[model samples]
Target: MKTLINITLLSFAMLFMSMLNAQDTVKKKNGEVLKVVVKEINDSQIKYYHFDDPNQVLFTLDRMTITEIKFAYGKEYKEEESIMTDDYFTEDQNMVLSLSMSSMLFDAIIISFDKAIDPKSGFQITGKLLGIGFGPSFENWYNRSGFDLEVGYKLKFSGLKKKKWEYRPNHLLSGRYIMPSVGFTTYSEDRSSSQIKKNLIHLGLKFGNLKIIQKLIIVDYYTGFAYFGGSKKRTLNSYGSDVDFEYNDINAGDLLGSGNFAVTFGFKVGLAFGQYGEQKEKLKRRK
Candidate 1:
């Protein structure tokens, strides 16, 4: 009788141990751990039920919030190990403010704003404040003023799933892209004897690579060509001598020129604001 009682107790203990081993464990990023019976897992979330509850009430949690899951059958799923197949950009990382370095060479400050519509595409606008920098001061000879505006559509060709598990999460707008742009520029120089006015309309296509550093700084390098069409006109006063009129050549190191067709190549450097800026501030506070 004593042997039988011991045997029966051992059997019950083994059954309880087996039941405990059948449960799954969920670990959250916030240091919470839960024992559950996993029901389903999709791309964005996971569905599960409490292992200890009698009613088995279902619960759902975002996959981003979870760190890992240890299954009952000795399998494991880690959130960090999963590959991002689509939509790599977050809402906070979608907008960028930048300045063109090459534009400063032409005595202009070109400020650009890019807003991402989706993970793969976006649009940008650039405003040029001409006659600000110290490229070639025309103040001694003539007063110069101009306005330039450009709008472009960007098609991103990176960070998408070309192969399995090939995307990096921090690569926001860091890759190759093709941009088609249209721009208009107008300039007027006022002198005592003559007034010179020039206008330009250009359509361009650019291929570029954008690189992001520390999730905040951006460097963009591009080369392309533009077709320019406009008129450069001068009005002469009574005292002014009228010779063969020639327009001031728009030349940048023999690479960019003013004519029917112009070659365009430049680099831009700037900081990414919005969410990335906030994150940098938070890190400073923590330190």
Candidate 2:
């Protein structure tokens, strides 16, 4: 409930601010500049006004045209570059403590699938909130959901030095699954069953894009190795050599255990919100 509320309030505030600035234009020191008026923002390449600007002008982002974003009044983003560079993320040690949330279209496992196994394979929207600190490379905490924590590490390499892009492969040791039950009875000789979960290990690759005109935001396309899944497990009876199996009404705990290799592939898109400025990233881009 707390998480939901926080997310709601944050979203509403951001949306409102964006709307209020739709007609405004922002200017920077360098020849590169941005124009913000009311609820609109105009850049050297494109202009965006209102939420749904059908006649909006869009421009191709050019490396040379990119410059540090300056705000009128006293506005700030979530993260800052000086904090990332002069301190943690810098030329000698490029690292950052990052946080993000994501939604996915499909999240499935690599194994073969059928109707039963793929029942929950349709579509899922999940969130990832993690902080990774880098030193030699980058490493930190991966907090998935409710104590589903993991020790994560990542290594990244850029395809091009001038663009705002990066490819990273990350690995993490995640907590086990703690399944909830529905209702069922198991009579496997000794009547053993499963409603609990287990721990897992996973690896993933993320292609990331960083946008720094206003805030430090990240948009990433990601997929992982172990496809963790959620389901309502139900345990029943087993049949004899020639007899038929039987089942009975059960509670949440009656649900049995099953291999959770995720119904579909592990995929999601993530975004990071900030309340400060990133000076270091700006300097790097200019270079």
Candidate 3:
């Protein structure tokens, strides 16, 4: 009876040890739960082995897809804690509507809409209405009638750290991006004695940073150059003498003339909507 009791005690101890070495639980963002032996976790991926497999073949998963992990040793890892260190985009919050703050100073109302085609790329369209804002009245130039249309394709760079802080992913559209754009401007400027109609086309490349504030406001600043062409020269007098009239400032020339190279820069403020905005609202409600 003493030997039998010793054997029973040893069996119970072995069973308890086995329970302590059970599999880890991995919960995915899609609500799938995985039973596995986690092997390694890096910045972008998680490596694991199936718990039921005797051979212990390895598998890999994107770290972003995982929401939580409960280890057998009573340790828990939550994905939310590391979200700010990574870059990701949700399907719902992928669009932005912005107004050009700099354009208003030029007596133009420039409104732009941006649509994200994917996490790394998107497109933008801007509509410009000239001579309608509370800008400086160009008294020398009257009857200013024209519109400008611009379209651009944006390519975003990932894995770049923010200058002000650590790798924090707060906004749906926050990063450094390069954009190639095409624009068309057509307008008639009526001077006191001479009226000139100008039509111009330009090809431009821009480098910009977009930042989101308070999960609702967007601030975008960009600087670039545009090659303007396809514009007729301004005839200064009724004699119809074509002269190359240019502005000393590059930005002014870029916005007002053609057949030359000009510098472009602007600031825009706007709103962010969709999935991220919805999430922000939900968090506010919870608070």
Candidate 4:
């Protein structure tokens, strides 16, 4: 009777062990069910260990290719795919809008638009309106007004390959960049009874970077110098049938510099939204 009772207990233990060993199943989207033990689950992938292997080698599969995880005890877990990727230079995130006040911070507004040509380069255009309606009361400020249009291309250094460096691929507008641009500007000075207008052509170099938050907010910091050539125009009459003007200090010279160079610097804060992010979400849902 003692030996028979011991045999019965051993049989019950084996049955319980077999039941525990087959406690989980990984179901693929194709309707195949894998009877494996699940070790972990995340938005990107699922990790598990097989039942027959003695070493318990782990395997991970992308959640997009999976359907659901069904446990032996009747619990089920679904997979979710995250839409954001490291590549941000695609259509939705590639375009940027920025505004910077650079002309002595007194009475100027600069608006810029940028488009990523690729992962490592981009193109930008800016419009600067100077002295619209603000008054310069500060000691070192000048009552100057102007309009400028500029075009430039940006080259990024972080896009270069490095040794043992691990970074997300195609991260545009988020690193250090150097840009060379050409622009034209018309500046005016208000005198007691007349206005002095100057037309300038400038070449510039800009160095800057942009930081993004939650894929929405963008913070831009930049500085540069422009070599310019200009010609002066004196308006003889403000408003009259006999309006007159005089041209002075006019010169046709090299594009580099014939007039002077000025420092350009400013900060810009703006928002970012696009269809690329939405497309990723749709793809994730469809998969």
Q: Can you tell me which runs of candidate 3 are displaced by over 4 Å? A: 1-88, 137-143, 159-170, 233-259, 275-287
lDDT of each: 0.73, 0.27, 0.73, 0.65
Once all C-alphas are superposed, what RMSD does model 3 give against the true structure? 9.9
Query: Which digits, one per residue and each the tens of the lDDT, describe model 4 over residues 60-149?
Result: 986766767887778988754434453333444766787663333446667788866655778989887766533342312335666778
| lDDT score at residue 103, model 2, on the 0-100 scale | 19
* Model 1 clash tally, residue pairs: 0
Q: Considering TM-score, where higher is better, how would the candidates rank from best to worst?
A: 1, 3, 4, 2
**lDDT by residue for model 2 (112-203), tens:** 01010011111112222112212221111211121122222323333212222211111110111111111111111212432222233322
Clashes of each: 0, 48, 2, 0
Structural similarity to truth (TM-score) of each candidate:
0.65, 0.25, 0.64, 0.56
RMSD in Å for candidate 1, one decimal?
8.2
Q: List the residue pairs that clash in candidate 4.
A: none
Error of 4 at 227 (Å): 0.7
What does the lDDT read for residue 143 in candidate 4? 51
Task: Tell me which of candidates 2 and 4 scores higher on lDDT.
Answer: 4
Q: Which stretches of candidate 4 lie over 4 Å from their true place?
A: 1-92, 101-104, 133-143, 159-170, 235-259, 275-287
The candidate 3 region of ten consecutive residues with least summed lDDT is 248-257
lDDT of each residue in 1-287, candidate 1, tens digit only: 99999999999999899877589999986789999999999987899999888888999987767778999989998776555543445424656788888766666677889866555777889887766655664343667678788899999887544332333354556678999999887877778889877777888898988888877889988899888777777788865543336654443221246547788787889886665344445667999
Point out where model 2 deviates above 4 Å: 1-147, 163-194, 203-215, 227-287
**Model 3 lDDT per residue over 50-72, tens place:** 88888889999977677789998
On the 0 to 100 scale, the lDDT of residue 6 in model 3 is 100
Q: TM-score: which is higher, 1 or 2?
A: 1
Candidate 1 regions with alpha-carbon error over 4 angstroms:
1-16, 23-42, 46-88, 136-144, 162-172, 189-195, 235-255, 275-287
